[model samples]
Target: MEANDLRSYISSHKNIFVLRNKQFRDSKLVIDGCNLYHTLYFTSGLDQAQGGEYGDFETVVRNFFKNLKECRIKPYVVLDGGDGGEDGDDGEFRNLKKKGEITIRKAHALSTGRLRNVLPILVKTVFVQILRKLEVPFVQCVAKAQWETAALANEWNCPVLSNKADFYIYDMKGGLLPLWSFQWNILSLLNQSGEKFVRAKEYFVERLRPRRRRLLPVFATIASNDDIHLDKGSLPNWAKPSKGSTATKDIDALFKWLSKFKKQKQAINGVLSHITDPAYSDKVHNVLTQGLEDYQLYLSSIAEFFTSGTALPDSSPCLPEWTLQQLAKGKLDTVVMDVLAKQRTVLSFPVENSLYSSSNRTSQPIRQTIYALLLGVTDGAYVEEYDREELEITSSRVEAVLPSKVVPNLQLETLKDVKYGALGSVLSYWPLGTQHATSCHLVGLGYKRIPNNLKLSYSMVAKAKQQFFRPRQRLALKHVSHYSFSTMFRPCQKCFASDFWVLYC
Candidate 1:
């Protein structure tokens, strides 16, 4: 659950948090890669209402890394892509399991015209490309990155750069630079080395009063909507004490009450005893205990990657070892990692026409191509893709399309060794064209020029040749900024619809 309300209340509090303004420079920064990209994309002012302007996003990412180099900040980015598992192993990715539910919720929101910040599917892919292009150090975790990132930052004795309020729970000697207050765009006044700096607010748990420190995990569990939280019906109206809706007063009242307790168990019990009904007490106790346990750090497998450059989590057996290395090194797209390993993927809601059917339907053919690249190469396989149905997320298995003719001898392990000619041949091969798929829909973007009113079947474009993928890519990058993917199409009166017309008509 999100602890937005609580983090907001804390941010407003002066004594407990105390984000001191500082000039940050000359350090190895551990960045939350997922947080950085989300902040970058949202704040960049690039087109969000359209599918996405990834070329512009590419430039934005380039500039960011370029600026960091000028400032001498060696950035080590860790992205959240893996599942943080249960049994509380090394703060792994079991925490990320809820993402499926969240994806459905977001898809639901997008379907209902309630969401405006729909991210395009390839943003993370583009981020990886730029990082590799710039030779930036990064790791795509097989599990949740929190423990790995925290461990790296602590070992380096440098601050972690992020906007995740959960950093307040971790005790850091160097501190936490809240991404919200990080003025990275502006450089500092000329220093002795002529080095640049980011003026930002730094957070240290030590700044809090002695007794209140180290209790943030407990506080977050109580405040957030994340896993291990009690049912909302059982939520103690900490606000009840004030008999008012003001969260500030309630937070103060809650803190004052919590100050007397010494141990975490006592705090958990005291709150349970006071607010929750006795019937729900046992359930509440278990939930809070489990939630608090999330913050308990173990030996992070991710940290080993930084040291020996070897530690990476296990994926499905079908995935070649080479693919896992590429994924961990940020060389391959995570989409490939997802389909082969999990046999499932959650597609993003692109900014397209709302009146027509879901825009996700239009791009279904493209994703099936990726599935083919991963699964259909050697043997036929199925992958479940999550796309929108009305306002709800619905799942259906898509069969991978094989390039049997183009790369008859090609296999997953030998993908990196695929020659240029074979690559082009494979790229031109349409992997999955359904019986009803119109060439215009796959080769072009469901229309040649602009879709005045178009919505495509999510599975229509299941597999596309590179030639087939490019025009649609252009639509997302070049045309969607001006045209909606939801626009409808019509056949030409005189001309037969062919690949050329799909590209030009």
Candidate 2:
């Protein structure tokens, strides 16, 4: 329903246009906040946080704002509220519903120990909070965030910042900002002389005729969306065409047929009255309406797919080849490497050693330790032994050794979970002039000292503290409060006290 494949068609036909950073200077930009959030989360590996203070969320938010400010762009971020009713009033709401359905299916899979990956939703609230604290202008749309963003973009005559390929369908005139400038590959297409080559964006915007006709491709994209085919079995007969006939093909045929009629409605009706039976005309109208409605429903479903916080199952034990290639190429940042290391550590053990080892397994004490360490339950299945039989074996002969607490409130289930994000947060709260020389030396980084003598400007340090330290403290406090509400542990007082000191200090 997302019309994801439409991007390929756009690329092949050279429809997307790119503007340089200079072009965006002082420009008003409307953003699809959900789209941007997920993009940042995946790229930065923030969505893996199950609970506690997640610095990656703050980092991603700060980086996003920094990018916008660097470009001198005024941003209006729109967030999806929820799924609105079936009248197709809100695009994001419908999308959320579809995603929710997918999440339910994925959740079932998760319960059965199936390897499924789910999108994270808890971070969006944090993102919105950060935006508010930064005083960035944003709106929580009553319906679909996309429609609100598009409407705002249209009204302000500004570009929309989103990665969704379907934004073209909104018929926005302000154009779209490429999600990230670096993500787009430079596509080469022929020039006017047919002898030279030009960038895809230039070729599409400058050379394409009848600019309004750009929507034609978008319409075609909708008709040929993957969701339609995915849901074809459930689709009404009117929604499906005969063999070898597609909605896109039929729509093209209709356009060709209509070209023979006069442009005006009265003329077309007069021609139809003479050439076709009234019943046939009515039937044709019905079919078109039904097809359009079905398409709308499919679009709604796409919205749900994204909104559903269903983590997809990873069937393979190893990292994605592209990820490995990136690491080999040294394209990954230190932070990314740290995240990858954490994942690698988790996957190093056999499936029987994992927390989600068996279907009939009672919650293990290690689960609580993992929850405390990672600040969230491990919500995924082990890749190597994903089958029901493999997962049904409850016995675990191996014992997990918990790591010592680095700080007052910090408790690590294993040293592997002590990645940069978790360790960095604890390090930030330690007393000034603390050093971990031996550990740093072992890692080939020489002696590591906290609160170094290098003096940073007051404003710089304040901004850094505000962006990094404060949000983490707040999130930790919130998590502590949740723990108290659930009464999950008898040592709540001790835990809260330690959390308070560590977070506040």
Candidate 3:
């Protein structure tokens, strides 16, 4: 391809921002199984990414592993196997597909070999290094059932890692966002036999070298699947409301269980102390509580989505075979028939049915000004900008009115509604921390029906957004403090860090 064409390809993928140079890699680094790794390559830039096959694929893999060692962060890769990909190679279908599994072919099919390439080489290479040289205890899982990861992590007494939005759906535990930072979080409460909820940070530290007095209940008090979509009237299900049982029974059960353990208050106080700087602690507590409250509100919002029948699958991007199978199984719950019939267009896509991953709804388009007081905003300027349009601009535009030329005011209103709709639908299965923060962010944005209990407004929403946002200056500061310049672009590291930022950031 021509240089310009390659450049364009790389630029397009830039939005996904997965570029992580060697500098970021260290034995201390823990990656989020495949999602972040894939995004890094696919989102680095349109030109480079589109010509991905042409690139030195193995080198990319090498650099990814190499960077991990240089960073001093123990690289633990989680094998999600979310597709259920099994051995008969069934075109890399779900792992649930056994050796004898077979299926008829469709005109278009994704390759199974490439799927295998996704992990084995990387895993084997990493394992060889750790088991032979690094002498670190690394953990991985390849289970038929996705939920098995939680079970294995619990049994082996190791950390679990994933980035699925519906992690709350399966109640999978140990949540960590690898690219953002080095910290690990316990994502779920489970059937594991060990002490409930080990903090990932402490767990990893202990793994490096045994430590005394490990804290039990290292996780926060998370509200389980409340299925807010049903409550807010989004999706309908056969299960009865879990709230009554949860409130009277579950809460009491949790507290009673806690009483069985000693140092409950002391443990809580110790965690609080870790975040001690008064101002920082206040923010931490605020965020933690805000996250919880959002979960509650999300529970209430589900009613609207269900009542309106808006939570049905989009099915616009499903894999061809999966789409046909869903059709054969009569799984296409809703479709824009006119569009399908008249155009004979492909309607199926990877339906993001998981609440934790994404929501089907859009957002509201209200014009409200939000002042972003960012650490990196030139001179740490606290610019006050009005929402004159619909676009949500955060980068260098510092403070600008919404509904910019790129986005319409109506689009913003629609987006607002979408967020509310998503909260309603996913609240049932999402963790309290995620759900609560989402709700608070929405309420802070002036969503009309948000209850007074949420105590959210545009300012609060901005703060929540800040948790996810990192000013360029802040990231730059982190990079400088963390590593030397020569190590930044070292070989064998993943290539999509730059792309991931553009899309998600």
Candidate 4:
């Protein structure tokens, strides 16, 4: 679901979000890793264009956690695996909804000179890097992290720090602390509790919500989300033309209509009764039912994973157990999940590129090399890339090749297999963060690099025909603060803190 729309609308309603100015006490906080990075990137006052200001971003994140440590707030971070869809009749619709979101983001980047927000693709990888560096306990879910985030928050009797509107629907013990209201940076210098507490808006779902709390999820089910993709144009206007036509009025119309029903079943029926064409009622019903189920509180699979060390089985044909553990531990990126699940990968635009051109053309070979590594064990493997071909999003089968034309004699097995050391020998320009399984460029070969620091002139892909842009500065990741960029790689995956800034970062 596009939760921001609902979140924004509800936030405007009176008595919803309450100020937690001095009430912000030391406690366990369940942090949504994806939301944390997404919100922090935009609020950090860094460049949305110019490829990326990752160095500045690192500092922003570091200071954020440093403040948390000062306040003694223990955080457990959880992040989404991908925009993956569960396989079923409506799976295509859901996948399209997710991809449509990407397309819209791309369009936003294209329309604006990137003055608007388009999260740098490498944000998650770098986020994981920072998390481990701070010794923060965290988990990267196999797919969605919202359920587990709420679960952990409930279990720990603590608040959730996220901007997801779904959190508003979940009736957790400690409620939600929205990202916009989480003023972690602003501290009272003269006050005694200066660094001892956070200032933010908290949502006490059971307290602040309307009398009909049960209908919260019901309202969410009818509101425009990924499942329904409902648009105002299709529905009758709840506001007048003179009153100013906006999505707010349409939402008001929904709430007004819902006010008539005493129970959710009646409301659901009422929603379906208005379907002008009977043909779509069944589909709408199914979607609404599924969305309602999303709000149902239960023991989270991720929580179970944390306790039992098991992994979610959403991947097709399933991934190797060791790979799953690495993902659970945040050692490996979800790129492995996408590769295993969809057999396709998405390519993002560089900030300096034209809307028409794909800036990642220079690094396609690296991606292909990665594709080869992940899929090499299987026969006649191919990976379709959701990339750009002049003003349109296009898919292409990336051709795989080994770096330096040297093949690493490693068996396609677990990440712990020492044969991967041979795998490290074949690749140049990078060493692992500390150990010897993966390297920086190597993980980026997994395609994290192409969308990241691999900046070439947007219009010069053919004319210049350059391989890659050199690092803005030359040094190791630990000494990065001395220069323009900073990185703290994961040791278990053996990727991070490499000597060369170009390949490692």
The TM-score between candidate 4 and the true structure equals 0.76
Q: TM-scores of the models, in the given order?
A: 0.71, 0.43, 0.24, 0.76
Global Cα lDDT for candidate 3: 0.27
Over 333-363, each residue of candidate 2 has an lDDT whose tens digit, in order, gives 1112222222211111111212332311221
Number of the top lDDT candidate: 1
Candidate 2 C-alpha error for residue 439, in Å: 30
lDDT of 4 by residue, 15-63 (tens): 4445454446578888998889989988878654433466787799899
- List residue ranges in candidate 1 displaced over 4 A: 83-115, 190-194, 226-256, 271-287, 298-300, 313-320, 335-342, 362-382, 399-476, 479-505
Q: Which of 1 and 4 is ahead in lDDT?
A: 1
Tens-place lDDT per residue, model 1, 461-501, is 33332234455554544533223232223334222111111
Shift of residue 235 alpha carbon in model 2, Å: 19
How many pairs collide in each candidate, listed in order?
19, 20, 110, 2
lDDT of 1 at 101: 47
TM-score of decoy 1: 0.71
Worst 10 residues of 3 by lDDT: 496-505
Residue lDDT tens for model 3, 1-505: 1212222332233222122321121123333444444544443331220112212333444554544444344544443322221221222232122111211011011122212212111222222223333333322222122234334343333334443321222222223232333222222232563222222221122121111112212212222221111111221221232233334333233323333335534534433455536775565455444333322211211122223522312233322232222221112211212112121111111111122321111121111111110011212322221111111111122332232322223221133232222122222222233443332123222222112212133343345446643453233222111211212222344332111111110
Please give the lDDT score at residue 167 for candidate 3. Answer: 26
Prediction 2 global C-alpha lDDT: 0.38
